[model samples]
Target chain A: MLLVAPAALYVLVFQIVPVVYGLILSFTEYTPLQRGAPTFVGLQNYAALVGDADFRGALWVTARYTLQVLPVTIAIALVLALLANRSFRGVGIFRSALYVPHIVSLTAVSMIWLWMYSQNGLINDILGTFNLSPQHWLNEPSSALNGVSVMRIWKALGSNMVLLLAGLQTIPKNLYEAASIDGAGRWHLFRHVTLPGLRPMLIYVIATDIIYLSQSFAEIFVLTSGGPLRSTTTVNYLIYTEAFEYSNMGSASAMAFVLFAFIAALTLIALRGGRER
Target chain B: MDRNERHTVYPANRRTFLKTSTAVLGSSLLVSACGGPSGGGSGADGDLTVWWPGVNPTEQDFVTEVLIPAFTEKTGRGAQATFIDWPDMSTRLNAGFSSGTGPDVYGHGPAAVADLVQYGRVEPLDDNLDQLDESDRKDLQTGLESGLVDDVHYLYPIASTGRQVAYNAEHFTDAGLDPDTPPTTFVSLREAAEQLAVHKSGKLQRAGIVFSAEAVGMQQAFTSILWAHGGEMFSEDGTSVLFTSDEGVEALTWYASLYQGDAPVDDNLGGTWDGLPPAQSPLATGDTSMTFTDPATLKQIMDAAPELDLRFMDVLAFDEGDEPAAFGGAATGLMINPDSQMQDDAWEFLKLTGSKDYNSMYAQEVGIVPVRASAIDTDYVKASPAMASAVANSEAFRSNPNIPAWTKIRDTLAQYLEQALNGQGTPKEALDAAAAEIEPILAEGR
Candidate 1:
């Protein structure tokens, strides 16, 4: 009990207190720059969120981005992990190369992709070589979020692959060997043995990925600034703009709670679906 | 026996040592708790701290090597200054204030005055300005009018920027246009853009003019063009929105046309120019031949491409004979912290910042035009004829509305403008949409 006291106290002071304070702030008109204490305004801040087109738009954007990024990232990562799992020459090098992007900072990755998406950037240069017109990667409302989604999917691939690979290693060798001895084909063995083995890790990856993808900010901030028409503005990005840019702390806090509720609901559904599986 | 004796003495000595150390530590802690940066809540007495953002090395050198020493010599006080990047300035200011360790003086854009005043974080400068000499007062009056809120001046104008047309003289010559004469009217501007744009197989190889779609505070770029065509974004009383008016619709229509191949620009071609790193500017790479930008940015363009020939003119207007109005004024200013204990010392520094002599030196070193009308005749100002002309003609420059919600308003306007530019909506629809949204915010603010 004594040993846990310090850690518990730290969490209570840092995390729990702030969350409680933020909850209280959500019902008030609070700005750090203001002269006096925050003025409580009941449910006005939360009520305003319901009618804010930008807020609703951001929620929709965040959902679409998550839908696009999560499944694609998991699928590609699983394929990469499967390839890397097979015994081959210099396999360690291949694994390390695959994992390199995971070690790099997200901001650095986003900046590199920003250059690639620029009008005269490498992406356009490649398109030019193929005699195709350069596409506006981030400027069009139709394609902007998809462009960010691609970059995010690439960024998330390595970590997911590594996690899935670890899950593959955990599967009993005898299970696969027995399945093969029973005349199971490669496809049959993978479907029956490998998939069941990887389910727990897959669930973990999907849950974490959803949480992370929903909270995407730096990529949108770096690549598009939530523009060419608010197509890329995530709820998290709008919350940031509200708090830091507009200094509307109360409104930002309200938005944060709404996002929290959203993430919690998704997390519950993910956990339940995993249990059923 | 000697060892036993030594042990006894050691224990006694340890007790004595502990007593003395506790006394010293207690006293030091008390001193530290009571005395922060003297005169400041965090810094020492007689020490002044000034916070400015994104000042170049030369500008910093001038502040450190010239201004601080001169200030100290003049007032018998020491001063320290910290430079923050522009994006981080607001966050830092908020954190500093919340922590109760804010600087004695800080610089912010003119648009921040309403918020600053509303928060009661800045000291009103009416008394300070009243102490100025008559000529100095007159010089500051016209510029300071924008910083005034409800008869109380919250920001002191330190520097000004006016958005004017900048053309690549080399590009003009290459495109068979006059290198010396840039466009002064919308018709000529569009013509020049069409002539200078280079297209290959339906792709824009080189844009004639480009707008910054992702630049920080890009609303100013659009508003400059809007105002140039005699459009008002808000009513005179600021009680209601007016951007849906015919003038506003016309301004946005013309601006949208720039992105539609009606001019040299196309929706898919422009890149983030302003608020990007100096090197990433399209004008620096000679991809775009013309833009509406400030002199400081133009200076940056010169730094990025020293060999490139550049020229500046007033922003294009609707009527050829009408004087072109630029959309910039007093973007940066110094305000004394209302909570500061070192207000007297800070005031001395603020007065120095407002002087012609200091401004001239600052302008020379920083490559920014001085806010002081008296400082317009300096050697640095004389060297840049175009900037000098802009600064001298203060009547031609207009600042954005200084309101608490200006940042939000600007961002909302930028979104709708992009919607129009990207063919998501018509210009009229976009402006009307923005007006619908912003009028409510403005009303709430009122």
Candidate 2:
């Protein structure tokens, strides 16, 4: 009890307390610049968001981003895991090379992607070689989110691959040998033995990806700044604008809770679907 | 390993982990709750701290090398100077002001004055103004006017920024337009731009001119035109949106016209003002013939491409008959924290920044326009043709409204402006939408 006390208290004071305080703040009209204490305007902040076009647009954008990034990342990650799982020459080097981007700071990664997506960047230079016109990658509203999704998928692939690889190792080799003896093909063995065994890891990956993708902010900030006409504005980015840029803390807190609820709901649905599968 | 074997190795279930964590947390809270806050006081420490948003390495070097040393020598008091980037300055200042921990003195753009005043974080400069001599007062009058909130000045003017229509002289000569004389009206400007433009296939290889849609919602590029047409962003009371009026709509329509004509620009495809480094700017790279630029940008262009022939002229007018208008004022000024305990020392240091000698040196070394009228006429200010024209155009300078909600209002307008430019909506519809969005924000403030 004494050994655990310090660690538990730190989480309670720092993490849990701030979350509860943020919840209370959503019920008030809070501006840090205002001299007086926050005026309680219960449900007013949430009600205003219902009529706010920007808030609705941000919610749609966040959902679109999640749909675009989550599945693609998992799919690519699974393929990489399968490739890396085999006993091949210099496989350790291959695994380490794949994991390099994951170790780099997200901000640095975003900046590198920002440069790559520039009009005259390496991406366009390669496209030019194919006699294709350079596309406005981050500047235009239509393709900005797609550009960010590509970068995000690339960044997330490593972690998902590692997790899936661990799950792959956990599957007993006896099952594969037994299937081979029964005259079952690779497809049949994988369908019956491998997938069921990987169900728990798949659920964890899908649920966590949904949560993180819905909370996207840094990429949008570095790339589009929610512009070329707010096409990349996610709910989290909008919350930052409301709180820091506009100093509307109450409204920002309300938006945060809405996002939290959204992520929680999606995560629950994903887990339930995974279980059913 | 099998599930039963794994369970034997790891006995801690989720339920047990939660129970143990709760027990530990409950006991820990009781022990830690007895402690109190570690710091004291609502005022500043004896030593003074000054913050200035640094533009470049030279600016930072000037502050650390020249300003701090001079202040320490003159006042015999220890002082520290911090150079923050422009984008991060507001966030840092807001946090500092909210927590009563802001620097004793700091410099910021005029647009931030209203927020500082509203938060009661700045000290009024009435006493400082009263102490100044007649000539000193007269010289600072225009610059100081921007710092006033209900006739009480909260900032001491140090430097100002004014916009100019900067053109590539080589491009002008190539297009058969006179290099010495630049366009002074909208029609002539576009005509000149058309002649200078180069299109390759469906893409613009080089634009004739560019209207930058960069920071502060493209106001730096559009405000001069808006003012030329006698448009204001807000009403006198700062309680209502006014840029949705007839003048504003016409100005925006004319501004958007440049995007599709012979002088066609595609800001969406990325151009001069894409927040790239100065070396990659359209003007520097010969991608644009003309742009509405400031002194800092002019300096950057000169630094990046020394061989390029550049010329500066006053911002274009609505018509030949209309007077040239530019967005200018004390763009950056120094203000004292209201809660500063070392108020007198901070004031003494701040006064040095506003002095004519200091400003003249600042203009010479740092390439910023001095706020003091006396300093504006110096040889250094005159040598830079752009700064000289900016000074000449200072009389017509108009600024954004000083209101707490101005940042929000500006952002809203920028979004709609982009929509109109992108053909998503008509200029009237865009402005109307902006008005609709801003009205509620303004009303909330009221």
Candidate 3:
């Protein structure tokens, strides 16, 4: 028990205390600027959330953003993992190059993406070579979310590929040999052997991706600022604005808890699906 | 091991657990206290700490290299200044206040003053103003008035800001318009914009004029237009939303029309060019012939592209005879933390910043409009046309209501204004929706 005390104390101080305090705050009307203790207004903040149009819109945007980015990112990442898994010359370099985006700070990556999506940016410049018109990637509501999603997919691919690559290495080479002897084709081998083996890592990747993607703030803030009419305002962005911009900490905390509940439910569903498979 | 066997091996008991928990908790608290901001508690005397809102390299250098040294030299006391980016200012300040680590002196826009005042977080500056001589007080009267909340001075304004239409002289001449006389009203401005607009294959090649279309910028642009049309954002008492008035709808209609018509004068919606490096500005890049921008940006553009004859029009009205107005005033200013042991020191620092010499030096170095009216005679203002125009029209500048909930209300309205600009709804509908959302916030603030 004495040996376990340090880790326990760290969690108690850093994690548990903050979560409990946040939970307590969700029931009160608090602004850090105000002197004295937070005023207890139990359930009022949560109740207000139900009728908040902006909050509701943000929830939808968050869900859409997650759903839009996850499957595409996973698919591309898996393909990259498979390619990198092969024993080829410079494969190490290829893997490293692919992982660069993941290691880069999200803010830095977002800044680059912001420029790349601008009217005279690299992406449009390339399109101009094909005699295509310049596109307002981050300006229009129709294309803004997709523009962010593409950057996210690119950013998330590296980390997901690395995880899948690690999972691929753990699979027995004998399984592939046996599948080949059994006359299994490449697709059949992947479906029957590689997939089952990689399911655990895939589950981990998807669950973590959902959590991260659903809470995206920095990119949205730097790129579009949840604009062209709140088309990209995620719940996290709204919660941030509520808490810091407006200093309505109680309502912001309520939004956070609601978001937490959503993330929990989605994660549970992913876990249950993984288990079923 | 089974649960009972494990318990027996550990010999755990309630008393033992309680003692262990207490020790850990006590130590954690001690560590936390030690790790917190140094000299943070109220009445802890030391050198003054200031958090200036803005990370402009020039401003940062001026504060560090010039201002701090001056303060220390004059007072025989040390000072620390932290340059915070504008967007992060409120968040950091909130965190500091909550943690009892707020600086002795901090700067934010006047919009935040009311909220700080409401919470008793800031000290009233009326007494401080009384210490100044009549000439100094009168010189800063306009800026000082802007920082008032319920007739009480809260922030000591360091600079003034105004948004004016910056036009290209060559574009005007090329469009068969006189470069000497600029548009005085929104009506004539739009007409000029139409003539100046360049289109290729039904696409805007060069915008005639660009108003900031991003969320925050849109609100400012709309506020400028609303004020020009003689519309107020709220009633005098600030209890009710007045932006839903017919004049507001008309102002928004004209503003939205710029991006809506077949021959749209502006193309970039939900994108901002306000704070971009001078070379990349729409006017500098020739992407737009005219744009609504502040004095600092305009001056930078002139310096960056001297060959391009850039001129700023005075604040515009809706009609030739009406009072011209623009969304600006008290861009950023300092407030004293009431709990600071160094309130006198903080005020001294603020006085130095607000002094005529420092004010003029700051304007010259930072390219911000000086808060003092006397700065007009300064060589910097006389030499720069943009600075001269801003100073001359200081009375035309208006700002968002200084209410506790103004930021939230502004953002709420900005979202709807964006919707309107993007054709999600008519201007009237957007204003109605915004007014509906804002009314409650306004009432709560009151």
Question: Considering every candidate listed, which one attains the maximal lDDT?
Answer: 3
Clashing pairs in 2: none
DockQ of 2: 0.25
Query: Each candidate: what lDDT?
Result: 0.79, 0.78, 0.87
Docking quality tier of model 2: acceptable
Please, what are the lDDT tens digits per residue for candidate 3 over residues B1-446?
88888767745565686677667666654443333333242455577899999998999999999999999999887888898989899999888887778889999998898898888888998887888899988888778877888888988989998999999999999999998999999989999999999998889989999987876788899888889988898888888888889889988988888999676898888887543467877888898999998998799889999999999998999876778999887887888988788878889999999999998999889887898888889999999999999989888888778887888888889889988887888999999999888888887877
Q: Provide the TM-score for each candidate, comma-separated.
A: 0.89, 0.90, 0.95
Q: Quick one: best DockQ, which candidate?
A: 3
lDDT of 3 at A246: 90
* Ranked by TM-score, top first: 3, 2, 1
Could you tell me the TM-score of candidate 1?
Answer: 0.89
Backbone clash pairs for candidate 3 read none
Worst 10-residue lDDT window, candidate 3 chain B = B32-41
lDDT of 2 by residue, B277-354 (tens): 677677887868887778667877877888898878776687767777777778888888776777788888888878
Best by TM-score: 3
Clashes of each: 7, 0, 0
The C-alpha interface RMSD of every prediction is 8.8, 6.3, 5.1
Better of 2 and 3 by DockQ: 3
